[model samples]
Target: MTTLPTTIKRLVNHGPEDYRLETAALPQPGERELLVKIGACGICASDFHCYHGAPMFWGNETFPRYVKTPVVAGHEFYGEVVAAGPGAEEHFGVAPGDRAIAEQIVPCDKCRFCRSGQYWMCEKHDIYGFQAQDADGGMADYMLFKPTSRVHKIPQSLSLEECALIEPFACSVHAVNRASIEFNDVVVLAGAGTLGLGMVQAIRLKTPKKLIVIDTMPHRLALAKQLGADEVLNALDEDVVARVKAMTEGYGCDVYIEATGNPAAVNQGLQMVRKLGRFVEFSVFSRETSVDWSIIGDRKELDIRGAHLGPGCYETVIDLFHRGLMTAEGIVTHKFSLDNWQEAFKTFGTPEAVKVLLVPEAE
Candidate 1:
C-alpha cells in the first residue's frame, strides 16, 4: 500500500464569512472505518448559508445550534476508497479502488429515531461537514467514513462529476417522494436550482398532470424546462400565485414543492396550493420564514411535509443515474480546484451556476 500523505488542504467553517483554508493533519481510519481520496465535492446552498451564519445551522430560539466550531465544510461528496480498516472491506462490500459515497447524516444508533428506522432524523443529528468530530466533511484532499456511516459504492460507469452529484440528487429524490404526487395532480415546484431541477426530472417520472417550475432567474427557468418541466414561471416577472391559480381554474395546484431558500417563496406556496394539497418544503433557509398559520390550518388545511437530507434514496438515485433516467448535464455549471474554494463558494446559487464543485484533482 502507498503511504498516506502527512497533511491535507481543507476548508474549515469558522463562522459567518470566516471560512479559512488550512493545511491539516491527515485523518486515519479505525476499525470498520474507511479513508477515501475525495474526487469532488459540491458546494450546496446550505453550505453557503452555513458560511453566512444561517440561524438554522448556527442555531436560534426555534432550531438548536448545530455547527461545532472550526469543522471542515462540505457534504455533497464522493470518492475512491484508498484504505479500509479491519473488517470495513467485508462489512461495506467494497474494496480499495472502488468509488463510494456516504449519507450526509451519521446516525446515533441509540437514538429513538435511529432505532425506529428513521435515522435521517436521528436525535444526535450529526450531518457531515457541520458536526466537527464524527462527521468532518469532504472539502479536503481526503475524508474518512465513520463506522456508523451509511455508505454505498459507486459504479465505475458513472463520470466523476455524476458520482459527486449523487448526493444532491438523492436529496432531490427524497424530497419528491415526500410530495405524494398523483398521476392527475398538477404539481408546482418552486426553485430552479440544483435540487429543484433534479426534482423536475424525478417528478416527470411520476407523470404529473402538469409540472410548473418557478424561479426568479431566466437561465434556471430555461434549464428547468429543458429538464422536463411542462412549464416554467419566472417569479421575478410573473404574479406566480395569480398565474398558478388561473391555470388551475382558481383552484391552484394540487401539489406544491418549495426548494428555493428564500422566505417569500414559502408564503407564495401556501397561496398557490389548493385546499387539501400536499406541500413538501425542502430548503435550508438563511432566515426564519414567517408564514400565515391560518392558511395552513384554518383556510387551506394542507398536508405540509419537511424534507431534510437524503435518506433511503441513495440506491434509487444510483439506479436512476445508471438507467439514464437522470443527468447532471445542465446542473453542474462550475468546477474549481480545492485551493480555489472561495471562488467556488461565492459562485454557489449564482444565476449562472446551478451547481459548483471542488475537484481535488483533475480527471
Candidate 2:
C-alpha cells in the first residue's frame, strides 16, 4: 500500500458559492470500506444548483433542505483504490491499484425504500458529497467509500473521463429505461447537454422510429446527431413544438424526455407529447418548474414519470463503454485541476461546454 498522507487537499463547501480549497486529515479504510486516490470527478448540474443556493439544496419555506452544510460537494466521480478494508476486497471486487466507482447514494439498508430494493429513493436519502460525514465527495486527493456503498469495478481500458462519465451515463440509461419506448414510437429529447446527448444514444439503441434532439447550441445538436439523433432541432431558430407536431402528422411525439433544467421545457413537453403519451423528466432544477396540471389531466392524460439516480444500470453502462457503444468525446469538453474548482464549476453547462471534469492529480 502507498504511504498515506496525514493531511490531504479538499474543497469543503461552506454554504452558497463558498467552497474553500484547504487541507484536511486523510481518511482510512475501515471494515468493508475503501480508501481511494481521487482520479477524476465530474461536476454535475446539481453542484451548480447547490453553488447558487437553490432551495432544494439550501431549503426554503416549502422545500426541506437537502445539502448539509460544511460538506464536500460532488457526486459524479470515480477513483483508484489505494487500500481496501477487511471484507471489502470481496465485496467491491477490487484491491489496491484497482479502479472503482460507487453509486451516489449510501443506502441505510433498513429504510422502507431501501428494503424494497428501491434504494435510490432511500428515506434517509444520504447521497455522497452532500452529507460530508456520511459520504464525502471525490473533489479531493483522497476519499473514503462507506461500507454501505454499492460498489462497481471500473475497467482499466476506459479513459479517465469515460470512467468519470459512467455516473451520468448510468443516469441517462435509467431515464431512457423509464420511457419504456416502443420500436415505432417517436421520441423527443429536450436539451443536448451531457445527459440529453447520452439519452440520444441510449434511446437510439431501442430503435425508436425517429429521435429528435433539441438544443440552442449548434455544436451540441451536431454532436447529438453523431451520437444517434435522427433529427436535430435548433430551438433558437425554430418552433420546437410546431416542428415536432408537423413531423408526427399532428399527433405529437410518442415519448418526450426532458433533460433540460429549464422550466420552459416542462410546458413545451406537455404541448408536444401526444395524448396518453409518455413524459419522462430527469433534470435537477434550482428553481420551481410550474406547468398547467389540467394539460396532464383534462387535456392530454399524459403519463408523467420522474427519473432519479442511476439504479441497476451502472454495470450495463460500463460494458457499453468497453465495447465502444458509448463515447465521452463531445460530452466531456473541459478539465480543470482540482485546485481550480471554481473555474471548473463556472465553465460547466456553458454553451461551449457539455461536461466539465476536475482532475485531482492535475496540479
Candidate 3:
C-alpha cells in the first residue's frame, strides 16, 4: 500500500488579496470517500474576481461575510486517486491509481433539487474552494472527494494540461447545448477567451450555417478561426452590430452565446441577435449587469437562458477529448509552480493570457 503524506501545502484564501501558502494536515478519507493527488488546477475568472474583492464573492457593505475564509482556492483540477476508503469503489466505482476529476459543486443529496434530479442548483450550493461544508478544493498537494461529490474517471492519454481543461470544456459544452443551434442557423459567440474559444470548437461540431466569433484580442480571434469558426470579427476595429447585420442581411444571428465576463458584451448580444432568437448567458459577472429588459420582452421576444456550472456534461467533454474533437492548443497559455501563484494571478489578469494553470510540482 502507498502511504499517504501527513501534511500538504495549499493556497488558502483568508480575504480579498489575502491568500497564504500554508501547510496543513492532510484531509483524511472516510467511508465512500477518495483522496486525490492534484496534478493541475486551472485558474478561473471567478477565482480572479474573488481575489480582487468582488462583491459577489467578498460581499458588499450591505451583506458582508459571504465567502468562507481560510478555504483552499481551486475548482478546475484533475488528479490521481491516491487512496480510497472502504465502499468508495462500490459507491463511485473509483480505485487508487486511477486518474479522476470531480465536478465543482457538491450537492446536498437531501435537497429537493437534488432529489428531483436538478442537483446542479442544489439548495446548499456549496462549491469547492468557496465553501468548506463539502470538499475544500484542489489547490493543494492533496484533497478529498466527499461521498456526495460527483466523480468521473479520465483517460490517461490526456495530458495534465488537457485534463485541467475538462471543467471549462464541460461548461462550454453545456452553454453550446443551451444555445440550441439549428442546422441553418447563424450563430454568434461573444468573447474568444478560454470559455469562448472552447465554445467555438463545440459549436463547430453542431455544423451551424455560420459560426462567428467576436473578440477585441487579435490573437484570440485568430485562434477562433483555427478552431473552425466560420468568421472572426475584431470588435475593436469595427461596429460589431453593423458588421453582423451586414453578414446576416439585417436579420442578425439566429443564436448568440455570451462568454465574456464584461457586462458590455451582454448589450452587444442583445443588439446582434435577431428577434425571437435564442440567447445563452454563461459568464460569472463580478458586478450587477444592467440591460434593457424591453429588448427581450417587447422588441426581440428572445428566449433567454442562463448556463451555470457544468451539469451533466463532464462525460461528453471527456468523450470529445477521447475522439480528438477538442484540442488545448492556444487555450492553455501558461503554467506556473504553486510557489509562483502571485505571478500566475498577475499573468491571468492581463488580456494576453488565455488560460493559466498551477501545477504543484512544476519547476
Candidate 4:
C-alpha cells in the first residue's frame, strides 16, 4: 500500500471564478466510508458555467442558486479505493484497491423520493461539488465516499480516460432511455458536445431508422458521424428544421433530444420534432429558457421529458464500455495535470476541446 499523506492539494470554489488551489488535511474514512485516491476527473459543462458566473450557478430568476462555495469542484471522476472504514465493504460491496466511481448525487435514503426508488430526485438533493454537506468532489488527490453515496465498482482494464467519461455517458444513457425509441424512429440529436456525442452512440444501439446529429461545428459533426450518427447536419450552415423535415417527408423527426446547453436548441427541438413525438431535454442551462408552451401542448402535443442525473443507468454504461460498444477515442480530446486546471478550464467549451480531463497523479 502507498503510505497515505496527511495533506493533499485540492481545488476549492469560493464563488464564480473565485476558485483556488489549496492544500488541506487528507480526509479520513469515517464509519461506512471509503478513502478514494482520485485518478482522473472530467470537467463538465456545469463546471464551466460555474466558473464563468452564470446566473444558474450564482442564483437568478426562475431557479434558486444551488452551488455552495468553499467546496471541492468535480463530480465526474473515478479512483482507487485506498482505505475502507469498518462495514464499508459489506455496506458498499467495495474494498481497498478496487476501482470505483460514485454517482454525482448522494441522496438522503430516507426521503420520500428515495423510498419510492426515485433517489435522483431526493428531497434533500445533495450533489457532489455543489453541496458542502455531501462528500467533497474528486478534483483532488483524494476524496471521500459517504455511506449514502451510490457507488459502483468498475473494471480495472478500462483506461482512466474511459473511466472519467462514465458519468456523462451514464447521463446520456438515461436520456436515450427516456426517449424509448422504436426500430423505425427517426431521431435527431441537437449539439454534438460530449453529452450529445454519447447520446448518438447510445441511441444508435436502438437501431433507429435514422440517427441525425445537429451541430454548428463541422468538426463535432464529423465526430458524430464516426460515432454512428446516420446523418450529420451543420445547424449553422443549413436550416436544420427544413433539412430534418425534408428527410422525414415533412413529418419531422420522430424524436428530438436537446443536449446543447444553449436555450436556442430548445426552440430548435420544438420546431424539428414531429407532432406527438418525444422530446428529451438533458442539459443544465445557465439561465431561464423562454419558449412557446403551445409548441408542447397544443401545436404538437409533444411528450416533453426532463432528464436529470444518471439514474438507474450507471451499470448499463459500464457494461457497454466493457463490451466495446462505447469508446473514448476522439471524444476525450485533452488532458492536463491538476496544477494546470486554469488552462484546462479555459480550453473547455472551446471549439477544439470535447471532453477535458484533469489528472490528479502525474503519469
lDDT by residue for model 2 (1-363), tens: 478889998888888888899898988789999998889888888888888888988889997777887887788889989988899999878888989999999999999999999999999989998996887898888899999899999988999878989999999999999999999999999988888887888998899999999988999999999999999998889899999999999999999999989999999999999999999999988889889999999998999999998999999999999999888887888888878998998898778899999998786
List the candidates' TM-scores in order.
0.97, 0.98, 0.98, 0.98
- Ten consecutive residues with minimal summed lDDT in candidate 4? 127-136
- Provide the clashing-pair count of each candidate structure: 0, 0, 0, 0
lDDT of 2: 0.90
lDDT of 3 by residue, 186-252 (tens): 9999988888888998999999999999999999999999999989999889999999999999989
TM-score of 4: 0.98
Q: After superposition, how far is residue 309 of candidate 3 from its true place, in Å?
A: 1.0
lDDT of 4 by residue, 1-363 (tens): 689999998988899899899999999998999999998999999999988899877787767888887899999988999999989999999889899999999899999999999999999888888887475888899999989999999997788878999999999999999999999999999989988988989999999999999999989999999999989998889898999999999999999999998899999999999999999999988888999999899999999998998998899989989899999889999888889999999999899999999898754
| Residue 207, model 4, lDDT | 94
The lDDT for every candidate, in the order shown, is 0.90, 0.90, 0.91, 0.91
The candidate, 3 or 4, that scores higher on TM-score is 4
The list of candidate 1 runs beyond 4 A from truth reads 1-3, 61-64
lDDT of 1 by residue, 142-248 (tens): 99998889999999888876887899999999999999888999999999888898899999999999999999999999998999999899987879999999999
Better of 2 and 4 by lDDT: 4
**Model 2, poorest ten-residue lDDT window?**
64-73
User: Where is model 2 more than 4 Å wrong at Cα?
Assistant: none
